[model samples]
Target: MVRCSHVHLYKNGKCNSWQIGKEDKKRMASNQGSSHLNGHSDIFLATSRDDQILFNGILFYLGQKYIEGAQHLPWWRTDGVILTVLLHAGPVEFLYYWLHRALHHHFLYTRYHSHHHSSIVTEPITSVIHPFGEHIAYFTLFAIPLLSTVLTRTASIVSFAGYITYIDFMNNMGHCNFEHIPKWIFSAFPPLKYIIYTPSYHSLHHTQFRTNYSLFMPFYDYVYGTMDKSSDSLYESSLVRKEESPDVVHLTHLTTPESIYHLRLGFAYLASEPHKSKWYLWLMWPVTLWSTMVTRIYGRTFTIERNIFKNLKLQTWAIPKYSIQYYMQWQRESINSVIEDAILDAEEKGVKEEGLNRNGEFFVRKHPQLKVKLVDGSSLAVAVVLNSIPKGTTQVVLRGNLSKVAYSLALALCKGGIQVFTMREDEYKKLKEKLSDEAGNNLILSKHNVPKTWLVGDGLSEDDQQKASKGTIFVPFSQFPPKKTRKDCLYNNTPAMLAPKHLENVDSCENWLPRRVMSAWRIAGVLHAMEGWNVHEVGNMMFDIEKIWKASLDHGFRPVTSFAESKAN
Candidate 1:
């Protein structure tokens, strides 16, 4: 007769070498694997083929008893009863062993299995405390088996309810971290030694993985030849190495940018809905504000500072210490240099002819000829306007920072098609002095004049600055600097220009403008939805609007009707 902790073989005498250590027992309890050692309950060993037969026998008997109790029910009802019970009970046991093995076999152990092993030794509660997904899988296994066999719905329900209670109690007992069962029970039942599933057994299952696959019954494991009869030393060796820790796996990669964008859009839609009423909006408003504030503060204080430190650290520790002052100075100088280069480059690079129009609106030519008359009275020619030139073309305007590369990009754009307007002579000269001759030539200079609406600094009025930044009209060809005046500009007749709508007020630009714009857009979208429009309808409308907008660019006409037609089509 084999004992619970010791295997007594008739030929080899008593094999007492398997006595579990006190530390191991304690470890098992702490880990929640010690719940299987109750004397009042029957323990099933799944290590050997004989154990598997015994477990099956128990399952069959349980099924038969359930069927016998429901014999008075109709045949169809009885079938339903048996199916439901088997479905409810069988899967839980099967998956406990199966998923445990699967987690070990698959790479999911790093994330899924490590939680189970948090206990070096097992305790009773540890049996079922797992990731939600793992728990669901375990539940599904039992659910499917019981549902399939039980014919009567009520019997199935009763069996499931009982099975759940039993499983819960047993699993809890296994991880209780204490051994309260009597030793006499084990002494009387010699084969019970191999049968009783102990915390030591289950702890070894987690600690080693190669052995102890059984849950309530060890018979399944024994028949399947998965039972590891080896000593506890083997279990200790299989534990995850500290250096090869599973924490290295990152789960963030599962999320994608598109998903994040859509989620944000959904939030925006929800927050903006009018019918959602004021209370919900009020609840969410703080979250939005806090997120924005935190992001900005983090960027300014941490991200920017970290960048400064990284750049300066290679040179000296003094850099990070003086980063603030250094960064300020650097930014000022760079801005000044960029402005100068932009002016100079624009002057040198002749704006190229962008395109010609048969309508004869300023010949529709590119502006490539760029000339900068320095404040010092020296002038520089950057590049020739290769495209056709129109008569009476004077002054060029440029966009972007006054850096050589920016100037060069502008020049490239001019060569592609855009016209040059005017170059600020004094600013141009200062820029040339800072750059090498070769790089100076590459600087981009635009032929388009800075719209009066855009010139807000110093000499300009607040109203003028606001108009320049927010004006929808493009500056006319005749408004090129060095010749045009405020009086010469027409208010409403100019072509629509693209300006940063959020920068209308200088004081408020840093704070209120972005929030206001975002809020407005969200509100608009929500209001649109509240009008009983579906998401698909909204998406289609947006798509149509975009199509028309693009078509207008190519056809030289704002095709509103065409947009409607496209949406309909």
Candidate 2:
């Protein structure tokens, strides 16, 4: 009688037979006993169930899509395999390469691809445990080859189903915590050996993503020069030292503030602090205000032009000379073209400027509306808002000069019924005083008490400061007195008091805030600003008013207006 480790009794009072080798049976009994002893059977079952559910869901969705596509191409067509391979292979290879590169792109890698890399030491389950977007992207990309094929409908469907099953098994086995499958099995069918991917092969692929991209066959990877043989050597070497402990790998250190900012931004959407009561919703108002102030103060100064050439050079790790020359040439052409157009417009408008300098710097000596114009005729706008001027307290200083062009913009936002908050009584008084004169008595100023927290301004009792610092935005302004100069505000005493080390390297005011903060700020601010205004009017007004403008030629539109003088009668 053949004994099986797993036994099931039939309703007919008979037992189904399965082969259980003597050694295998003993090992199985030992593992079961150990699991029972440690009370780990439930944990194992739960893990297994989770894995099964996830795998089944992914597989079912992918399979359904494949089947739908396959229905159009039946299996009766002769030479279908040849046609399918020919048509599908090239496009699949291209898309695979493109997506593979895109996965490594700075933004995508940080958010989506990084999740996959979390499992430094991968198992088959790890392959499927990725961001849903990434998983979908990979699945879709893989299916493209089948979709592009000219195989008969039935053949295509059958082949795709078989392929998925094969892939699933291979992926699982690759991460299988076992070694040494029968070598004779692979040797029996030499071609099928390459056709069917193995755990060993797929394991190497995960270990080093640059190679082993081929799902079933190595032919495409070889042709594309992406098939790395070095991973094979690494795998073989690992196997040779089977007795050695599994090598531990740690995640790469996120050493910069920018990295941390990105991480926080990605997580912020999903994270929520527990709250109760309608009034707690108002707490988010202050958070929104703080986010807006920090984002605006930081995002502008750090705007770098997106140069494809520079990016390519960085990717290749090229020398500075070539990169700089490439950048300069591109910059020169771009500037010159803008200047030519600007010069023509100025000449037509009867405006004069100083002769273009060697560096093409031009200056207008006098212009009523134009504060300062570049040789390229670009203008600068500055806004200065000084608030909270009181004795013994640091002045709430906002110093940036707004150009005549931006006056209308500022007015529109203020006029759109935004409740501007000021800490200083005098500052609020000044604004209120001007409102009737400038805004036709539409703007009203009420004495709403400013948050005491805002007045604290880096000055509070140690415990209070610590509490304020816990979740508050810390903007390190050069103009603000340093820790040594500030008598009241504690600084550099502990990690909480000090500016994050990453912020030290970030010199530009514009680049200080992360992108997500900027996005949230704009969204929150616009909503708040449009509170009393007609939604339609506010929406129309906001049509072209960009909240965040990158430093580029296209930064803000030049509004055209026709100025006419009344005829002398």
Candidate 3:
């Protein structure tokens, strides 16, 4: 193994770390995009045949100039090589600015430039991962600095070598996932940073796009008024642990067996002091083990953007790009059957024409004062409807945490229209608080109470009349609550339609342990069916599971299904 030097630079920040050295041969052969979990790629940093060809050509061209008495190359002349690099950047930057901008045009981005943007989280190698045409153009523009030195007869091999070295170094630094530069780097020099762009500044271009578009300097972006405002703070927090959203799939991720080996390191955290229950870790340990075993025995399902698969030319077990038809028949009438049965149940409760769904406007008879916009349907005439009331409607009826029902609600909130979410006084009050905190500033979540005819406004600051035509919401049940009168929160003479205490916790158990366990099994079901994991991915997962299994065995845990465990309980 080679020594891992250069750790000091990005040690604190979260960026793709790179070092100038020989790389592993095995990694290059696999040709995978990045470490699926850790998100890394070192192949781009390794010297390839293409680099040999380009550098050979450059050396040959420089060799001819060396014979023409260019040996001194301002070495002992009027000034130093740093002056030559700045001079080189001027013309190159001007030429590259327009070329780079042109590459972002729609057709060019799809065909050529978008390849670089394929990796949202970039590494040092990602810096040089441009298409052939783009790379060829880049090499040509970069050589202009050398060509000008030759044409003007102003520099030698040393100056040209140093100048090119500076260019490559800056390019690599821009792509590194870490921002090593301290705040005092600017405060100490002040003027130096105004010209140079930081790694985070360059990262924004990859993640956000349409801003910070200079070759190496920030001067052009400032002059063109295209600089991002949050560049500084974004850089500082780049390495910090991001606050997670409650509805994110990663929340349920099992990092235990993977990190169980690090028990000594995490022992303190597991032995909670306060706030968290002292027995929280011990209590959840068995639950975690059970959930993990269920998931391991089954498998997992995950989705990456289709473009990533296409761009990487990855070998997928399942089709990368999918049409609507691909997902339509997959459920095999199960969902259709459920909807039908639910609809039949609704009719029995005398729920006919309970609400007026005229054109796009809707008015529920139960909440007579409410006016709503009935947005388009989600699945099988199940509409996403939104409306506002006098004091504001809140308190949606769904309870269990992060189920299919909760996922649907999260998706509805993310429709770019939902501004605020309100919860009710229930057993899930703590969950509500956690969800609100994790949601961050993206949404306004509160514990306010409202009737069951829930409303999610369009999030516009304009008056209700002006924004009446645009908003979306969803009711988890097959039909809206059948409230015939203002005081009615349920259907007439039907206790099933009323709030039943027994059914409230049917989807879950104490502290939602059963829900979490079931969700793990559900994930396995998806993974077993999902066609994406390649042979290599499958091998890695199987290996991890073996280790987890051995670890569980040592702890007296015998993996068993809930059906078997429930009877014992």
Candidate 2, residues 396-445, lDDT tens digits: the string is: 22111222222332244346443333434554455455444544243333
Ranking by TM-score: 3, 2, 1
**What would the per-residue lDDT of candidate 3 be over residues 1-569, giving only the tens digit for each residue?**
00000000000112233222233323321332322222333343343326645864776567666756445455533343555676655878877877877876666776667657665667777777765677678778876756566666766667776776777799889888777777777888877666788888888776555777888887777777878887877766764543211101110111233222112223433312211223445665775576446534533322110111111111101111112222466642443332223223322322221111111121122223321111111111111121111125433433223322233444344343444343434424433443444442334444444234333222212231122222322232221122222222222110001111221222221111222121121122112112222111110012132332333223222222323346689
Model 2 scores worst on lDDT over the 10 consecutive residues at 1-10
Local distance difference test, candidate 2: 0.34
How much is 259 displaced in model 1, in angstroms? Answer: 58
For candidate 1, give the lDDT of residue 537.
Answer: 17
- Each prediction's TM-score against the native? 0.26, 0.28, 0.35
Summed backbone clashes in each candidate are 107, 15, 6
Show model 1 residue runs off by greater than 4 Å. Answer: 1-92, 149-157, 183-196, 230-569
Candidate 3 — which pairs collide? Answer: 15-177, 15-178, 16-177, 73-156, 300-527, 318-531
- Tens digits of per-residue lDDT, candidate 1, 42-106, equal 22212222443354457656665775443332334455555554543355556677777777653
Q: Cα lDDT for residue 219, model 3?
A: 75
How far out, in Å, is residue 428 in model 1? 99
